[model samples]
Each structure stands twice: as structure tokens, then as C-alpha cells.
Target chain A: MTDISRDDVQHLAQLSSLALSDQEVDNLRIDIGNILGYINQLSELDTTGVEPTYQVTDLENVWREDKIDDYGLGRDDLLALAPESKDGQIKVPKVL
Target chain B: MTKISDYISKNARQNVLEAIKRANDKNEYHALLSFTEARALERADAVDRGEITGRLAGVPFVVKDNFFAFGAPTTAASRMLEHFQAPLQATAVEKLEAEGAICIGKANLDAFAHGGSTENSAFGPTLNAFDKTKVAGGSSGGSAVVTALDIVPFALGSDTGGSIRQPASFNGVVGVKPTYGTVSRYGVVAMASSTDTIGCFATDAADAELIMDIMAGKDNKDMTTLPDFFKPTNVKPGLKIGLIKETTTDDVDPEVKQATLDYVARLKAAGHQVDEVTMPISKYALAIYYIVVPAEVSSNLARYDGIRYGHRAEGVATLAELYGKSRDEGFVAENKRRIMIGSYVLSSGFFDAYYLQAQKVRTLLINEFNKLFEDYDVLLGPTTPTPAFGLGENTADPIKMYLADIMTVPASLAGLPAISVPVGKSSNGLPIGVQLVGQRRSDADLLALAKSMEKA
Candidate 1:
């Protein structure tokens, strides 16, 4: 059985850029450990010389016109979806 | 009476009203997030006035809220996009609208389509159509319930890992997960990119075919869409069918296996050969799905930072805090579970061990399916290991919740077309659906085979 420590959970949250609470981290430490243990069963099978599939479409070199097409949405329409906007620009919290 | 043909003959406004009224009637089920009554009425009036006339004229339907349609906000049943109304409709929804289908409501789902059960929905869980105490199989639970309850003839859903099919199985409805790229994914919330396909839920296979015919085709907006290849065909008998030996093991419920065997017998009585076949790699497919899906999800969900559309943190002075807090608050527990697992697999140290290994095994799975399809026309299995469990049955353990997807995920990892069709019921009276998985573009053929079962 693989045991994921609290520190590992915290580090993973950092890598994922998620700010997990103390309770969340504690719960996830156990759950992620169980999941990783389950997934580790994949090592049982040998995948010698097998090619990895990234996407299933089997198509390559997909090219389209390099021109700008907004797909029919106006600037205001997009801005309306944001929480804060000013001067025709989306507003975010001040960066340190 | 709510079938597409029935709606075609009825006054459009009346049909829309009846569905909305039914939605109101079944409010406790929490199937629909928002009923677009006003918009539906307006569209229905247009169809009645002869301004809108198409194959599915005035047929009211529902969409899983992940679809970026205009009538309501596409919550994706997540707090992140709770208020983030879409600027444009999904291409699949647009095609359905062009056929004069009026979308009256947005259905519930697992937040970001994460969990197998709707318990992860930020709103609330949708009770099963059969027993209120049981779960509505998810993340397409609401779509399945609305169809089973006859609120609408059909509804749209996205199947990433049997999100459409399993729920349809639980609710005794028809769910289709078309071959990857069979329908355009534009404007739909992205989950696992390689396996996510837009499909529908309906009361019968023929209605599903009509909806698939309208939605299936190439879309310039979504480059992966195949050139229109879907055509309705009457079921042709004498095709070779294989019963997956792996799915009928001791771990599966007896009633579920009996239902599948009963369906296989029906196929045989109708003059087709049925035999047990083995695909050993499927036992590892679920593990591979967890690894590959989380990797894709972590990357796909990376776009939901606070900067653009979606929820933003209320009190964060730094940009990193803003992103971290908003994401931490927006995603549900299972979503975070998958994301962090994704981070673990894709991280530099673990890359070769986890992600790369899973991908290689994925190829083996696809090859196994390919080899099986070389001899068999389609493969059959129980859509789920068991019938619908209670709402809180698998919620405590994320792995337990994921087990609901095991029988359904092997076909998904292969990017094949599969459907869940209701065969019989459990002794407890819950619905059971048998799955038919076909080769990559043989979607219409699979549906035809399932439809033929009705005649049998």
C-alpha cells in the first residue's frame, strides 16, 4: 500500500496551483494515496516497444487559415462574462 | 407523446409548455438547472408561425449545462462557471437548433463531469428515475432522468468516461457515445480531450438516431469532426456479435449478467451468432483511464484561471493567490482529486512511470479492440457492474465512485462508438442497460443493431 503524506499532498497542491484548505489536504492525503495505489497496478503489465497514443484522430499537420476570425462575438460580449472590467479591458486584482 | 414525431405534429407552444410544466412537476428531482420557458415559447411560436420548419420542428429538449447554449448559463455544475453565461452556443446545440429543436432547459451533471455519480454536482444530486432513494447515474444523470420521465423526447450529453451511457443505463434510456470526433466539440466545456464526444439521450434508439443524424458531421469550428458519415440503417441480422468475457465475471452482479445474456439470447433467436471473447487488457483500462484522463483534465482545466471568464476570488491581492483561491473554491472535491492526480502523473519525476506508461497501455487497449472488431461486428456487456446504487452509496470514496465507470471506460479509451440500451430490469425494479460497442465509425451500425433488439 502506498501512503501519501500530508507534505506530499501539500506539494501536489502547489504543483497544481490549488490552494487547498487544511481539512481538504488531510482528506486528500488519504484519498490520493488510495487512488495512486489503485493506478500502480498498471506496472504489472509490460508495454515493451509499444507506441503511446496522444490523440486518437490519427490526423496530422492540421492547418487552417492564419487569419483572425473572432467567431462572431463582440468585445463587449466577452467582457460581459468577466467579473470586473474597466476601459474596455478585463480587470484583475493588483499584482504584487 | 413527447417523441420528435409527436412534437412535429403537435403545436410547438403546447409541447414546450408541457415539458416545462413537467419540469416544474418534477422539481424535487432537480433534473433541470434552468427551464428556458420564455425563450422556448418564443422559438415554439416561431415554429408554429411557419418561420421555423425543419425535421425536428418544435421538439423541446434539454442540455447538460456544460454546453455553451444561449438560454441559460453553462454552469457545468461547478461553482467556477456558476454565473459564467456562454457568449455562443455549442456547435452541436447550434445544429440541433437549426433542425428546429427548442432547448427548454439545462440539465444537471457532476461538476466538470468528474464523478460517476451526480453527488459531486455543486447544486445537488439528481434522484434516480426509478427510485428516488437511488442515484441518477451521472454526469449525464439529469439528461437521462428527463428522457426517462418523458419530460422531453431527448436531451444532449457529453460522454468522457461513460457519463452519458452509465446514467442512461441507470435510468432506462438510450445514450450514445459516438466515435471520437463524430460530432463537433466546439463551445462545449472540455474534459478529457481524446475521449470526450457529444451524444444524446432518448427514450428509444430511433430517436437517438434522428438526433445523431442532425448533430453528426464535420464542423469547420471543430477540426477533429469527421466529414458527415452517419446514415440511418434498418437493423441487418446475421452479423457477428461477441460477448466480452471480462465483463461477465464473479465481480459483476448476477442480474446484470443475466440481462446481458438475455439480450444475447434475443440476438441469437433472431439468427445471429454470439460467442464469448476475451480481451485481457480491459482489466487495466480503468487504471489507464485514470492516468490519461487526469493528465488531459489538468491541462484542459488550466484555462479556467481567474483572469478570463469564470469565478474570481473575492479577496486576493496577488495574481497567484487569485488563481489558487478561485480554482480551489470553484472545483469540487473529485475535480481536485483528478487534477492533483494529474499533476502527480505529469510531473517531471513521475512522467515516464505514470503518464507515458498509461499511454502505452492505452495503445494496447485500442489494439485489442481493433483485433476484436476484425472478427466481431460489435461487442456486448453490462453497461455497469450493477444497477443504480443509493445516492450516498459511493460518495465517500472517490475510487468507489469511479468503479461505476469500469465496464464503460474500456470502449472510451479506444475512442470507439458505443451505446447503452435498456434491456430489462433488476429484480429490485431498477433499470439495466446493455452496452453495444462498435468499431470507430460504425456508430449508425451499432444504433441499428440496438434498434433491431426492439423488434426482436
Candidate 2:
């Protein structure tokens, strides 16, 4: 079984953009280990030449008319859903 | 069963009012999060006054909270979207409303439809309709319970893995997880992009078929939707049925196995042929599902970064802290576990070993199902390994909780339509369901087979 360390858990939390607490990281360390061990059973399958099945709609490069489609959603309505909005734009933390 | 016609025949106002009362009375079960009483009553009055006219006029239903509808926020039982009012309603809800079906309330679910049990819900777990001690199997537990409790004749739910089917089994209702693209996913909380399907739970097979028919069709908003193909038909005799060898193993609860076997016997008695078929890759389907689904989940859920809608962190100066803290606060433990696992599998070094390999095995699983479909019109099995378990039984172990979906994920991976039909009760009086899996686009025929059994 693959044992996930606290550091490993932290790394994953960082990757997922989740600021997990020490207790949460501790809990996830064990749970992630068990889940990884469970899914590790897939290593036995020999899928050498098999192609990956991504989307299953059975359609290829479905295209629509090259035009703007608002889907009946107005800009002001969507912008209003944000936590903070400026003049026609969403406000965010300053990035250096 | 309170059929749709029953609601239409009765005074629309009284029908909806009584249903809302019954649902409110069953508050201990926690089947519904909030009632859309004002909207529902308004629509009921309109229907009574002949303002609205359609197939499902005056019928009341419930939507799992993941779907966007008016009157209540689409919480998905998560703190993130707990107060996020939907700007638009799900296409499925719109369709039902177009047919005059009134959505009376929003049902509870596992946070973002993450766990098999609604224990992962931020608010609280929905109790089983039969026994309060046992879990109402989820992530669509509330929909199943509402239907089982007769609060509504039918309720809408979204099934990614076995969310609808497993919960239906636990609560003893007919639940359909239609072909992946049969219903549009627009305005529905995204889980796993590839497998998320819109379906419903109903008291009977004919009602299930009616609900599915209304919900199935293409929508331009969701590009993944398939063309309209669902049509109800009489069950044709002499259909070839495959009894899956994997689901009836000794490890499965004896009662569940027996329920499946009893359903098989009924199938034979109804002049259908049954044969044991082996799809060896089904043994590995759970493993492949965990990898592929989480990868999709991680990608899909990335949208909840405290930027647009939903929850945001308080007093965080830096952008990084804001994103991180808001997400950590918003998501339940299961959501983080899945996202982290997805990050690991889809990470640079492990991509080929985990994500790509799982996808490859997925293709193989689909191939095995295709080969088996050549011989059988439908495949039969136990919907779950066991009956509804105690509320806290599997919550401690994520792996144990995942085992609840082992028998149902193969169909999801292959994008096939499957349904859970309540067969009988276990020794303890808990419901036992037998699953019917059909080939792609064979959803109508599958419902017909279950309906034929009901008539018999």
C-alpha cells in the first residue's frame, strides 16, 4: 500500500488550491493512502494498445455557426453574481 | 402510487398543498432541504384555472438540490453554493415545467454529489425512508426518499455513478440513470463531466418511463446531449437477458443475491431467456472509475475558486490565500479527498500510470460490455452489494463507502442506461433492488421490461 505522507498531502492540497488544516491533512493522509492502495489494483491490467475513451457523445468536432451566442444570459446579470465587481469588471486581489 | 393523472384529476391546489404538507411532516427524514411553496402554489392555481396545459399538468415533483430551480438555491448540499441563487433553471426542470409538472421543493444530496451516503452533506445526512438509523443512499438520497415516502409520485435527480440507482434501491423506488447524453446537464452542478446524467426516481416503472421521456432530448446549451430517441413500448417477449456473474458472488449479501435471482426467475416466467454472462473487466471497473471520474471531477470543480459565484474567504489579502481558504471552507472533506486524488493521478509523473491507464481500461471495459450486448438485450444484477447500511457505518472509510458503487459504475463508464427496480424486502424489511442495464439508446425498452414485470 502506498502511504501518503503529510508533506505529500500538503503538496496535493496546494495543487488543489485548498488550504487544509493540519487535522484535515492528517485525516486525508490516511484516507488518500487507502484510496490509492485500492485503485492500485488497476496496475495489473495490460492496456498496451488500447486508446483512451474521453468523451462518449460519439460525435467528432461538432461545430456551431461562427457567431456570438449569449445563451440569453446578459453580462450585467453574470457580473452581479461575483463577490465584488468594478466598472464592468470583476474585482480581484492585486497581483504583483 | 399517486400517478400524475391522479394529481391532474384532483383539484390542483389541494394536490400540491397536501404534498407540501406531507413533505414538511416528514422533516425528520430530511428528504427536502427547502420547499418552493409559493412558486408551486402559484403554478397549481394556474393549472386549476386552465392557464397552463400539458401532459403533466398539476403534478408535483422534487429536484435533487444540485439542479438549479426557482424558489430555492441549488446548494448541492455544500456550503459553497448554500445561498447561491441560480440565475437560470436546469433544462430538465424547464422541460418538466413546460409539461406543467410543478417542482414543489429541492431535495438534499451529498455535497456536490460526492459520496455514496449523504453523510458528506454540509447540512446533514438525509435519513432513510424505511429506517431512520440507516442512510438514505446517495448522492441522490433525498430524491429517492421523497419518492419512497410518497411525498411525490416522481422526483428528479442527477446520477454520475450510482447516485440515483443505489439510493433508489435503499429507499425502494424505481430510479433511472439514463444514457449519458440522453438529458442535458445545463444548470446542473457539474460532477464528473463524462458520466453525469439527469434522471429521476418514481414509484412505478410506467411513471419512470413518462418522466424519462419528458426529460430526454437535445439542448443546444449542453453540447453533449444526444438526439431524441426515448419512446415507450410494450415489453417484447423472448428477450435475451444476461445475468452478470460478478454481482452475484458470495461476497454480496445473500438477500441482495436472492432478490436478483428472484427477479431473474420472474423474467424467465415472463418468457424471457436468462443466461449467466461474464464480463471479466467488470472486476476492475471500480478502480478505473475512481481514477477517470476524479480526474474529471477535479477539472470540473476547478470553477469553484471563489471568483465568480458561491462562497468566498473573509479578510484574505493575497489572491492565493483567498482561493485556498475559500475552497477549504466551502468544500466538504470528500470533495478535497477526490480533488487531491485527481491531482495526484493527473499529475505529470503519474498521468500515464493512473489517468491514461484508467481511460485505456475504460475503453476495454466498454469493449467487454459491447461484446456482451451482442448476446443480451439487457443485463441484470443486484443494485448494491447490501441493503441500506447504518448511517455512520462506512463514513470512516472512504474505500468502504466507494464499494457501495462497485456493481453500478460499469454501466456509467460505458454510458449505458440502467435502472434500479425495487424487487422485494430483505429479512430486516429493508428494500432490495435489482438493476436492469441496457445497451446505449435501449432505455425505453429497459423501462418496458420492468413495466411488463409489474403487470405480471
Candidate 3:
């Protein structure tokens, strides 16, 4: 079994940009640990010299014209989806 | 057992109204999230006035809530997007609309298309269409149930792993997961982009075929989409099919195995050659999927950091707090579990061991499939190891829940086209499904074969 510590879970949460509660961190510690243990079974396979498959489509570097097509959605329409907007731009908490 | 033809002969308004009424009647199942009544009625009136006409011609349908459609908010069954409306319709939805298909409502799903059952839905679990005590297999659970209940002839679903196929199996419907890139993913909520494919659920294979034919095409908006290679073909005679030996082992439920063999027998009656073929690497597919998918999922979900759209947390002083708190509030437990797992695997020290190793193993798994396809036109297996499990039966243990996808994930990891067709029921009376997997670009053939054997 994977010995995923509470701190390990917290570090993962930080990496994932998630502010987990003490209870969540405790629960996820066990849950994520079990998941890792299950997925670790992949190591049993002998994949020596096997090339990794990143994407299934044989197509590569599919280039398209740089023409901007918003599919009929206008700026206001997109801005309308944002949680907060001001002065025709998205508003966010002040970045340090 | 509704069909596209049922609505084709009726006025668009009548079809749309009837579908809406059925959806409301079956509300206890929690298959639907919200109705697009106003937009549907307006579109129905247009079709009645002869302004809209096509093959589907006013046939009503439902989309899994993950899709961006007009009338309702496109929540991916999560609190994050609960009230978030899509700026544009998904290309798949647009294509269906072009064929005069009216979308009456959005169906429920596992939050962010994660988990094997709709039990993970943030709103609530969608009840199985067959027995409310059992779960609706997911994350396409709601779409499958709506079709099974005959609320609509067909519905759209996206399959990243076993989302569409497993649910369709549980609900006794036809589900299609086209070869990777068969349909554009644009306007659909992205989940593990490498494996995500837009597909549909239907009462029968023919409706699934027509829906796939219409939605299968290239879109400049999504570069991963293949140049439309899907052309429906009649099943070739005396086809050689491989019944995967790994899937029918003693560990699988006896009823599920019997149903799969029964389907194979029907193939034999139709003069197709069925052989038990070995693919040992199939055992490791779920492990590889768990690693690679979550890694991709973590990256894909990073876009939901609360600044641009979706949910936001108030009372956060710093930008980091805003990002963290909002995400913590917006996402459900399963979402967090996947994201953290993804983070752990993709982090610097573990990247090579977990993520890269899984990818290499994935290649090995696909190679085994390719080798088998050389002798077999298609591979057959049970869609799930068992029938629909009781609600919350495996929810407490995440690994137990993940095992439900063991049979279907191999085809998904290989980016192959696979379909699940309802065969028979277990002694306990739960529906069982047999899955047919074809090589990439053989989406049309897979459906054709399933369609031909529909009666049997």
C-alpha cells in the first residue's frame, strides 16, 4: 500500500491549486493512496524499448489558417460568461 | 422503443411536447437536469412552418449536461458550472440541429465526466432506468436512461473512458464511442482530451448510426477531428470476430458472460466466425488509463481557476486564495481525487515512473490489440464485468468503482471505435450489454454490424 501522508496530500492539493479542508485532506490522503496503489500495477508490464503513445490520431502538426473564427460569438457574449468583468476586460483579485 | 421515424411523421411541436412530457413524467429517475422548453418550442414552430427540414426533422433529443447548448446552462454535472451558460453550441449539437433534431433538455452525468456511475454527480445520483435501487452507469448515465425510458429517441454523450458505453449497457440501449477524433470535441467540456470523443446513446443501432453519420466530420475549431471518414456500410458476410478471452473469464459475472456468449452465438447464426482470442495486456489497461487520463485531466481542468468563468469564491484576499478556495468549493470529491492523483503522477519526480511508464504500457496494450485485429475483423466482450450495481455499493471504495470500467477502457485507451448493444437480462433481471470493438476509422462498420444483428 502507498503510504501517502497528509502532508503529501496537501502538497498535491497545492500543486492542483485546490484549497482542501482538513477533513478533505484527510479523506483524500487515503483515497488518493489507494488509487495510486491500484495504478501502480502498470509497473508489472515489461515495456522496455516500447514507445509511448501520447495521442491516438496518427495525424501530426495539423496546421490551420490563423483566421479568427469565433463561430458567431461576439466579445460581449464571451465577456458575459466571465464571473467578474469591468471596463470591457475581466476583473480579478489584485495580483501581487 | 421510440425511433427517429416516430417523430419524423409527427409535427415538430407534438414531438417536442411529448418528449418534454415524458421527461417530466420520469423526473423521479433524475435523468434530466433542466428543460430547454422555450428554445425547443421556438424551433418546433420553425419546423412546423417549414423553415426547418432534414432527415431527423424535429426528432427530440437530450444532451449530457457537459455539452454547450442554447436553452440551458451547460453544467458538466458539477457545482463549478451550475449556472454557467455556453457562449456557443457544441459542433456535435450544431450538426444535429442542422438535421432538425430538437434538444429538449440536458441530462445528468458524473461531475466533470469522472467516475463510473452517476453517483458522483454533484446535484445527486441519477437512478437507473431499469431499477431505481441500482445506479445509472456513468458519466453518460442520464443520457442513457432518458433514451431507455423513451423520453427521446436518442441522446448525445461523450466517452472519455467508459462513460457512454457502460451507462448504455446498464440502461439497455445502444451506445457508440467512435474512433478518436471521429467527432469534434469543440464546445464539449474537455476531460482527458486524448481519449474524449463525442458519441451518442440510442434505442437502436440504426438511430445511433444516423446520429454518428451526421456528427462525424472535421471542424477547423478542433484540430484533432479527423477528415470525415465515416461512411455507413453493410456488414460483410462471414466476418471473423474475436471473443476476447480475458473478458469472459470466471471472475466476470456468469450472467454477463452468458449474455456475451449469447451475442456471439447470434453472430454464428448470422454466419460470422467467432473465436476466443487471448489479449493478456487487456488487464493493465485500467491502470494505464488511471495514470494517463488524470494527468491530462489535471492539465485540462486548470483552466477552471475561477478568474475567467464558472464558479468564484468570494472573501478571498489573494489571487492564490481565490484560485484555491474557488476550486475547492466548485469541484466535488471525485474531481479533487482525480486532480490530486494527476498532480502526483505528473509532478517532477514521479513523471517518468507513473505517467511515462503508463504511456509506454499503453503502447504495448494497443500493439496487442493491433496484432489481434490482424486475424479478427472485430473483438467482442461484455461492456461491464457485471450488471448495474446497487447505488452506493462501490462508491465508498474508489478502486471498486474503477473496476466497473475494466472491460471498456482497453478500447478507449487504444482509441478504437466500440459500441455497446443490449443483449439480454440477468436472472436478477438487470440489463446486460455486449461490446463490439473495431479498428480505428471502422466506426461505420461497427455500427453496421450491430444494426444488422439488432433483431437477434
Per-model DockQ: 0.83, 0.76, 0.86
The total of clashing pairs for model 3 equals: 0
Quote the positional error of residue B129 for candidate 2 in Å.
0.6
Report the error of model 1 at residue A75, Å: 1.5
- Can you list the residue pairs that collide in candidate 3? none
Q: Which residue ranges in model 2 land beyond 4 Å of their true spot?
A: A93-96
Candidate 2 residue lDDT tens string, A29-57? 99899999999999998988899999777
Tens digits of per-residue lDDT for model 2 on B25-134? 88999989999999999999999999987999999999999999999888999989988888899999999999989999999999999999899999999999999999
- Candidate 1, true inter-chain contacts retained: 0.81
The superposed Cα distance between candidate 2 and the true structure at residue B151, in angstroms, equals 0.4
State how far residue B122 of model 2 sits from its true place (Å). 0.3
Model 1 superposed RMSD (Cα):
0.9
Which pairs of residues collide in model 2?
none
